[model samples]
Target: MKHYLLAVQIDETVPEPEDELREQLARTAKVSDEIKAAGAWVFAGGLLPSHASTVVRPGNGTTTMTDGPFAETKEQLGGFWVIQCEDLDEALAWADRCALACARPIEVRPFDDVV
Candidate 1:
């Protein structure tokens, strides 16, 4: 099996009520548990708002840190899951479940491994 990253994209332009946020969190947690039970879960975590992100750029043998995400977009990566899957189809299947559970768009990418 190879590793895949299932990234959850969320729109940050709109704000969610506290109650709705709690409900989605609960639903996502349930999906995480299901993924673990299926032995496909490596790890999963949610991120803070994109504004909390720091971008580091190395130049002239020095690094500068910039606040916010690298790109200006309405949607940002809100969370991600690392799972081991046989192929893209399996990864997409997991992404489908995650998208439904989290009510967000999921981007599936395979990890590079040379052996």
Candidate 2:
């Protein structure tokens, strides 16, 4: 089995209403349960707003810490699921369900294996 990251992207400019957010969370939980039952769920979690993020960069001989994400974009990574699947096709199928449950775009990326 290969590990893949199913990332949920959110448009931070728009805010989800309280009721909608609750519903989305419930749906997401249901999906998570389904994944776990299938034995593919490694781990998953949601994230705080991008404004709360800090970036650490390495310089010549020291490191610089800055507020915010590495890039300035309307969309940011809101959550992610690390899952083990047979191949990209399986990962993409899982991403589709996750996108529906969270009402956001899901990006599927395979993790690099140690040589």
Candidate 3:
């Protein structure tokens, strides 16, 4: 099985109302439960806003740490799910469900094999 990452993208510029946010979370949780039941779930988690992130960069001889996300974009990675699937099609099916549940875009990518 190949491991794929379903990354949830959130547009920070648009604010989600409390009620809508709650409903989205509920729907997302249901999808997560389904993934787990299918024995495809490896891990899943939601993240704080991009502002809460920290970036570390390597320099000539040292690493520099910076507050906030590495990229400056309205659309940021809000959460993700790592799951094992038979192929890209299976992963895409899950991504479709996830995107609808969260009312956001889902970026599906497979993990590279270890050498």
For each candidate, how many residue pairs have backbone atoms clashing (under 3 Å)? 0, 0, 0
All candidates in order of lDDT, best leading: 3, 2, 1
For all predicted structures, in order, the TM-scores are 0.94, 0.97, 0.97
Against the true structure, candidate 3 reaches a TM-score of 0.97
- By lDDT, is 1 or 3 better? 3
**Against the true structure, what is every candidate's RMSD?**
1.3, 0.9, 0.8
- In angstroms, what RMSD does candidate 3 have relative to the true structure? 0.8
TM-score of 1: 0.94
Model 1 RMSD in angstroms? 1.3
Judged by whole-model lDDT over C-alpha atoms, candidate 2 comes out at 0.96
Model 1 spans > 4 angstroms off? none
* TM-score result, candidate 2: 0.97
Tens digits of per-residue lDDT for model 3 on 1-115?
9999999999988989999999999999999999999999999999999999999999999999999999888899999999999999999999999999999999999999985
What is each predicted model's overall lDDT from 0 to 1? 0.93, 0.96, 0.96
